[model samples]
Target: MPDPRTHLVGPAAEAEIRRLTRRSLLVGGVATAVGAGALAALRYGPDEAGIPWFLRRVLEGNERLARATFSNRLAPEFPRARAAIPRVNGRYGMAETTDSASWTITLVRPDRHDAVLTLPALYGLPRSEMITELKCVEGWSEVVAWGGVRFSDFAAKFGPAPGQFDYVALATPDGGYYVGLDAASALHPQTLLCDTLNGEPLPAEHGGPLRLVIPVKYGVKNIKQIGRIEFTRKRPADYWAERGYDWYLGL
Candidate 1:
């Protein structure tokens, strides 16, 4: 999990990135139209300042649009047909030495009631699988086969109807990076509490003990190292959204 204080892009950084991108693109366009020898210079300008935030945003938006246009409302696959799991990007919660034998998912309620569920308890739910595009906010996407129980099933066992809980929250054991999901997305038929990625137990880099997989959201919302899950009626604060990104970074 990433610390919101350290990993987030502040408003100032965002503004500068946007400004540089627009200037570079404008200069590049003008140079191209004039067939100027300076076109090469303009082409390399933005890269010199590091990639523009807006361009990165455009790439992410394009990915979202593409997935929305082409992805069928389908789930991932069985044990043998999963895609190769990608490298782990960060370890917020999963890095803690958890004794898998004793791990339990703690669910906090609006009334402050807390319920703890073990892995076997979670696995006992109606199982499901999904094959979907895992889109990262940083501009990459992959198709992964996931095997898990639907979140709705988990919700039902502990008592909330699929769409009844207003928010779902997850965090690493260290509480470094946390994300929140709305009820609609939480209960969406495609949302999964994944136990396997690409037919194997998730690699430590990819959030091993258990993680979330949802086609309708960017990777950030698919938090790793899930130490706790909470159901709330109010909108919960999210790690990235607090630092100036859109709260609904949905696909």
Candidate 2:
């Protein structure tokens, strides 16, 4: 058998090895510098400067575009046959188990009048069901069947003075995870205070009893185990938004 070592001892192989080593070193150096710069900026730089500033501006730009193009276009829905069970993604606000039987959805009207609502109260209103995709910011999506009252119906009866508020805020039972939405998107016909998933009472892990299902926006905006719904003239603080994700996470 020929000696394989002899082949790799040639001038051509040596030159190729040298070229590869140089390329690898150059790539490694650039990667390290970039990683270090990002870490330093995150640790030492001011929030209004460097990467944070750029991210803020990008988020603002995205909000502007989402608003400018705002439409009541209904998100396409599929047949129930196509729906799948959604994975439980996060439990930030759901760490504490809730008492579903006694759970109530509190509405803070724009006029400052507060109303407490029950699941039966929501069911008393006309119910709507849709099989729509819940798209997560983490790059996964699931088509699931959601049944509940139309947010429009809820707003019509309980919303703050019509058009009196520009934003709506929702928080979890523990007030840990929160999301804000523009009134237009919040009252969209498809937006639902969902109570049922896949023709059954929503499972606890899936934001059971009641949750917000806004197909027009990303799943982060669809807060689970909704405890409070407030109408506000100002933009409300959001959980993911504060952590550098886009506030208006529109589809």
Candidates' TM-scores? 0.66, 0.79
Residue pairs with backbone overlap in model 1: 1-91, 1-92, 75-130, 75-131, 76-130, 76-131
Estimate every model's Cα lDDT from 0 to 1: 0.72, 0.85
Residues 1-251 of candidate 1 have per-residue lDDT tens digits of 87554453789668777887999999999878787645544554454124444544665576457545644355443343446566566665557444556767788876546888778887678877667778888888777887788887877778455455678888877788889887767776778888887677766567767888877788889987677998888877788766545565767
Candidate 1 TM-score to native: 0.66
The root-mean-square deviation over C-alpha atoms between each candidate and the true structure, in angstroms, is: 16.5, 8.4
After TM-score superposition, the amount by which residue 159's alpha carbon in candidate 2 deviates from its true location, in angstroms, is 1.1
Off by over 4 Å in 2: 1-45, 48-51, 95-97
What range of 10 consecutive residues in model 1 has the weakest lDDT sum? 47-56
| Tens-digit per-residue lDDT, 71-181, candidate 2 | 999999998789999998889887446677799878887686688877677756898889999998899999999998898898877777786999999998679989999
Q: Count the backbone clashes (under 3 Å) in each candidate.
A: 6, 0
